[model samples]
Target: WSLGLKGERRDLAPVSTSYYRVQAPVSTYHHRVQAPVSTYHYRVQAPVSTSYYRVQAPVSTYHYRVQAPVSTYHYRVQAPVSTYHYRVQAPVSTYHYRVQAPVSTYHYRVQAPVSTYHNRVQAPLSTYHYRVQAPLSTYHYRVQAPLSTYHYRVQAPVSTYHYRVQAPVSTYHYRVQGPVSTYHYRVQGPVSTYHYRVQGPVSTYHYRVQGPVSTYHRVQAPVSTYHRVQGPVSTYHRVQGPVSTYHRVQGPVSTYHRVQGPVSTYHRVQGPVSTYHRVQGPVSTYHRVQGPVSTYHRVQGPVSTYHRVQGPVSTYHRVQGPVSTYHRVQVPVSTYHRVQGPVSTYHRVQALVSTYHRVQAPVSTYHRVQAPVSTYHRVQAPVSTYHRVQAPVSTYHRVQAPVSTYHRVQAPVSTYHRVKLRVDK
Candidate 1:
């Protein structure tokens, strides 16, 4: 602690040898209270020392305690100083409240019984004029309702889509059903026609014939031949003969009476027979001589005859004329004539010699009175003829009737159906 003295004092000189006794004490006082006020006090005691000190308070009072010494040094001299402090402390009390609610439930109710009885008593007054007005409180709530229009509209859109899909399926089913039966029937018809179309074969035949003829002829004819002949007649003769005659009767020629021989016959019928009685006398009455007789009647000449009669009577020469007789002569006949073929001669005889020389004539013989005849003969033959001929032929044929058969078969058919669905909401 330091104290400043206001009164004059004297310093002691270095050479003075006197002992100085300085006693310094300083005291500082700090006071603080609950009122948050601070007070400070300083007190000094001299011989005089230097001192420094401070005090502070922010919200409330505080007590600060210090115990320390002051030190001073001069030219090697050291001084020791003393410090003092005084504190005044006032008692202070502080209060603080803190409350926190817990996780449990709590309820508090308070009712006074006097009020309850008074309230029950008022309810028993039925005829009492009681005007009660309750405040009009309206509560408005907003409720959202699900409308059927939205669901119906959704169903409508789905229905149109379903139709779009079903259209193609229905069309396809119709196409499948339309021509199936017709096509099968057409195919069966063509098959039947083919089955009925069968074929047959051809045919052939032949024949022939023939004929012939002939002829003949005839003829007639006549023929004849005849011939005749006549024989030739001619006469021829030559004769040589003798003829004699005697005549003259002598009277009473020769009577001889003397004869003795027998006389056979004598007859004198008439005439005067003079009997000559001179029988023996020579008779000389008369005698005559004649020539020799000629055989042919043609006398050429007389023959001389000499007779010897010697008696001559009256000498008378009786001369007789030549007497002649006629005689017929025979003639020779010839007959031989014949002719053949076509030759003929006709003869006419006025005077014919009627003599036939042969009994049976030759090819031509005849009497002496007619001409010869001729004969002829003729002959003929028969005839014949012939010819040739030909003829024609023919043929025919027939064909068999056609035959056929038919048959049919069925084909497989298929059907299809589409699936459909309906929804109700």
Candidate 2:
């Protein structure tokens, strides 16, 4: 709460916004909250405990989440916060998914059940700094929603782009919600989708939903990624809409970010004609209708997402869209409040990934939002740490503005640190 912003540069435009005491430090977020306006408040006061506390309030309501590091912090809420606890009704058994997660200390794999204490649904980020998680799926698996799969389109204002989602799930469950090393959890609803199109509004941030499910609908508007991925000097092609295939992003081509369902074998079918049900199941047929881009499931099925992107460290750079396009430089330097708690009194922001990539985080270091429609994150880590967070309920300036819009702490979850959250979806 001391360092306001050394040489930090920012370009945020809060329209008709008034804030109060929002404190979230850029480095070391030992947050502390007195009493929020919410119904319940969670505290982590244990001196030496590292458990992931999770809570989901009614949608559209005032939802402020905080997830802090666990190392002898001090307080408990009876809710399981350690040893990886899933706060859901349906007990999971053998939740399998092929993922490689090792966040410096813990390595997760949704390949099995959460039976053991150490093994939670975590995925492994590859060499450079690329990893995927099924919405809840730790890695590579389809991280989907139960009924509806929503994907929020990132809107760029100034140079800093913001991805927001206002998802409204009818009746769902927190299949796999907790903190770990990697990420992979699928939202299985349908079988493998024929034309895999990523719909921003519907939140199709799926990873690997058991069977072929989601359709990557082509978003007419080219949604620019706000990630400072300004380092792809390789064959970093402009991957626009759901049509253009990401050819050389060898790092971790999330082209199929929301590949919901356990789509069996993605056959390499040709063009013009489309085989709707490219599945090994019911054998449903797809008309191969007149859609924007060809079917992602077939056109470039199997080896989808990342193209030939292998060792291009600066590859993400070239991928930042023509620099002048957005002229976004003060992107990652976003300054936010850091709520420092006293000894043995830690505050847990539901914004998991506090330790995302523990050591080798992407260009960004901290910040991880919870994508509502199931999908977890796209940008994943942050440039450094806490940027757009909120302070405790101190002042009342949030006055008329929906408290959720104050800042990080407010719509925060939606706010960044690589806020991979579909907050307003």
Instruction: Indicate which candidate wins on lDDT.
Output: 2
| TM-scores for every candidate against the unseen true structure | 0.08, 0.18
Task: State each model's CA lDDT, in order.
Answer: 0.15, 0.19
Candidate 1 displacement at residue 323 in angstroms: 18
Overall local distance difference test of candidate 1? 0.15
Q: Per-residue CA lDDT of candidate 1, range 1-425, in tens? A: 11225752332222111112212222233222122221111121112222112111111111222111111111111121122111101111111111011111111110100000001010110111011111111110110111001110010001100100100000000001011110010010001000010011101110010000001100011101111101111111111211111212212112111111111111111111111111111222111112111111111212111111112111111112111112111211112211111122221111111111111111111211122223221111111111111111111111132212221213222222221222111
Among all windows of 10 consecutive residues in model 2, the one with the lowest summed lDDT is: 316-325
Error of 2 at 112 (Å): 18
Q: For residue 161, give model 1's deviation from the true position in Å.
A: 99
Please provide, for model 2 over 1-425, each residue's C-alpha lDDT reduced to its tens digit, 9 standing for 90 to 100.
11115753331321121112222211122223223222111231221122322212111111112222111111222222223322311111221122122111121222222221212212111111112111111122211212222222211110111122111101111222221122112212111211122221221222222322223322222122222111111111111112212111101111112222111112222211111111111111111111111112222221122111111111111111111111112112111111111101112122222221111111222212221111112222222233322211111111221112111232223222433322221
lDDT, residue 303, candidate 2: 17
Clashes of 2: 125
